[model samples]
Target: MIVQLSDIELTARTLVMASQILVILLGFTIVYIAFQGYRRNRSRPMLFIAVGFTLIIGVQAISAGVYVVFDVSELAAGAVSQAAQLSGLICILYALRMEG
Candidate 1:
């Protein structure tokens, strides 16, 4: 048996790309909003949120690169992206716990 680029795979990949675009854009917007909040009243939690979003944006970019540039399997890309996402959240949690 042989396999070719079928319509289903193409459709799925297109959907993934579109979602990635939306995720990255939303992450950037979150970071921007957090930055503005931090700047307005100089809040520590807002700073942590901004930093978290920055890390999240980086992770999203790398995940998309793996999907589009490296052409990794979807499962592998999801695993890597999930790990990075968790790590980013952990950092933010630590930041929140620490004294500022």
Candidate 2:
């Protein structure tokens, strides 16, 4: 039995999907923790962090929907990907603001 390159690529893609699912679950967990901290501490900064994570998750969810609707169009897919990247960057900046 010989394993071909295509089989390897397929396996990689499957692993990537699994990893993505794990990451999304982790993100939800973080969001939950942030929400709890915000509630307990009543800190404006923590609230901001929670909102940022919520925005990031919302953007990703919207992008996923866009991909489902426009999967056949490369342009549409690229636009959604770009939007997701931008939202993710904004989330990073928001997270960094905790230090400032």
Candidate 3:
């Protein structure tokens, strides 16, 4: 069966994809900066920040791709994405709490 999307729907999807790409790029840039800070200062918190950003941004995109490729339920994909985001938040929080 072939499915056709309306013009509005197609446009919305395109906008969403473009935004997601932008978010991913920004996330990578943040992680890169954090890693650079870590390398320059030898700060564990900066390393954690890098890892946290990667998990928060990269994992959700990866999970979304898996959902599309594997035909997973939306709920399952959302749960995975939420989990990754939560874990990332925790990492970021821990980084904030650490000294030096």
Candidate 4:
């Protein structure tokens, strides 16, 4: 069956996709800055922070791709993305607690 989206729906989806792309770009920029901080200070905490951000954003991006490419269910994709984000948050928390 072929379904067609209304103009508003199409525009909304387009805007959402554009926003997601922008978010990915911004997220990577943050990761780059954190990695640079790690390089400058040689801090394990900073390294972990960078990794955490990467995992969070990278999994989100990948999950979107997987959803589109594999035609996976939205619930499954969301679950995978949420799990990765949870892991990433744990990394960030551990970094915060780690002693310098």
Q: Model 2, stretches more than 4 Å misplaced? A: 1-5, 71-74, 77-81, 84-100
Comparison by lDDT, 1 against 3, better one: 3
Identify the runs in model 1 with alpha carbons over 4 angstroms from their true place.
1-3, 66-84, 94-100
Ranking by TM-score: 3, 4, 1, 2
Better of 1 and 4 by lDDT: 4
Model 1, range 5-68, lDDT digits (tens) per residue?
Answer: 8999999989997997898889999899988988998888888888887877877698768798
lDDT of 2 at 23: 73
Question: Which structure among the candidates has the greatest TM-score?
Answer: 3
What is candidate 2's CA lDDT for residue 1? 94
Give the per-residue lDDT digits (tens) of candidate 2, residues 30-93.
7788879879988656666666676666566666667778654757766766776577657657
Per-residue lDDT over 5-77 for candidate 4, one digit per residue giving the tens place of the 0 to 100 score: 9999999999998999999999899899999999999999999999999989999999999999998999999
Instruction: Compose the digit string of candidate 3's lDDT tens values, residues 1-100.
Output: 9999999999999999999999999999999999999999999999999999999999988998999899899999999899999999999999999998
Write down the worst ten-residue block by lDDT for model 3: 60-69
TM-score on alpha carbons, each prediction: 0.67, 0.66, 0.90, 0.89
Would you give me the overall lDDT of model 3? 0.95
Question: Which residue pairs in candidate 1 collide?
Answer: none
How far off is residue 84 in model 1, in Å? 4.3
Q: What does the lDDT come to for candidate 1?
A: 0.83
RMSD of every prediction: 3.8, 4.7, 1.3, 1.4
Model 2 TM-score, all chains together: 0.66
